[model samples]
Target: MSMEGFSKVFEMYEAFRELSLSRHSIREFRDTKVPQDMVDKILELAATAPYASGKKNWDIKVIDDTQTIQAIADSIEAYTTALAPKIREDFREGFIEYSQSFIAFKDAPLLLIPTFKVNYSLSLMVEDEAIKAWERDNYVKSIATLSMIIHQGAHALGLGSCYMTGAVIAQEQIKKIIKIKPRHDIAAIIPIGFKKER
Candidate 1:
């Protein structure tokens, strides 16, 4: 390869390394709107991530509506509130505090829910329930891979995002609000927007 071409490749590698190392989860965001095109771009980049067993097996649900986002937040808050009492008295307060992070996406301009379909192609062939269950869950790993790509793609675009698992605690409520199919399951809730100035 020519020196110029090698230099360009090294520069790209350095940039990717910097992005990977510097990026951190963003819990708060400014009200500035995230354009649909930008959202589409991130997902486009995310689609390039490799899929397991040559099956895409995953999809993303985008929520940009303010009211609907708020409703999702309220549901999480209510569910956690009800769940608080079940915790030991000393731990209840801490649990409530921790639950707040689950709904941090309420303030962001866009929310992405990466979902995976249960694929039984490999699992169904197995007679052992244990192996079957493992194979079933393996399909779900695609969403996590997709989510990380989405995060890096957003970061490359100067946007901030958080990969949230806590929100999945209220997946049933979230599913009703988003009208997701029964076979689909929540992988993670990602909120994206411009970072709020400290």
Candidate 2:
């Protein structure tokens, strides 16, 4: 087809409005299974996400095993349950209540934990100490941008997902289970599954 003809035919795919509008932060999940192939396809789309210097020095730990998921979820709950009381009184009760469901990693069939190496080579290369903060911010932004890609990618594949940062709250304990070294920057724990039909 000609350029104009193609453009007219593909007008609906031009804008990302429908994708954006359809995606939501899903909390509840059905007992439906999300096969490894579908997860791999979504990861493939997520891998195409761009980063600084093409340095894709990020780890995407896919936890599908039920036992490991429960362990990680337990650690998250242990940490959050204790920490929730220290939060501002106005939000504490709600926060604790939410953690019951929020920290339950095993409930979802797929868990994607995205972490970036906490390498400061860029900061160290710069002579000015103040430049370190800029490097740090950029590193975080790089991984965060990739997380957005993964979230949208999952949605596109008819999978519901939640960006669960509770995993980071107990990063120390969860790292032992996930075998990740401490201090590696964990962006968020994403739980993917079919949304429970209401």
Give the top-scoring candidate (TM-score).
1
- What's model 1's lDDT at 163? 94
lDDT of 1 by residue, 3-116 (tens): 999999999999999999989999789989999899999989989987777788788888899899999999999999999999999999999999999998899889998888
* Candidate 2 lDDT for residue 70: 87
Please report how far candidate 1 places residue 105 from its true position, in Å. Answer: 1.0
Model 1 clash pairs are none
lDDT of 1 at 47: 90
TM-score versus the correct structure, for each prediction: 0.93, 0.83
List candidate 2 segments past 4 Å from native.
1-9, 12-15, 84-95, 98-106, 125-130, 181-183
Q: For model 1, state the Cα shift of residue 77 in Å.
A: 1.1
The reply for model 1, stretches above 4 Å from the true place, is: none
Pairs of residues at least 3 apart in sequence or in different chains that clash in candidate 2: none
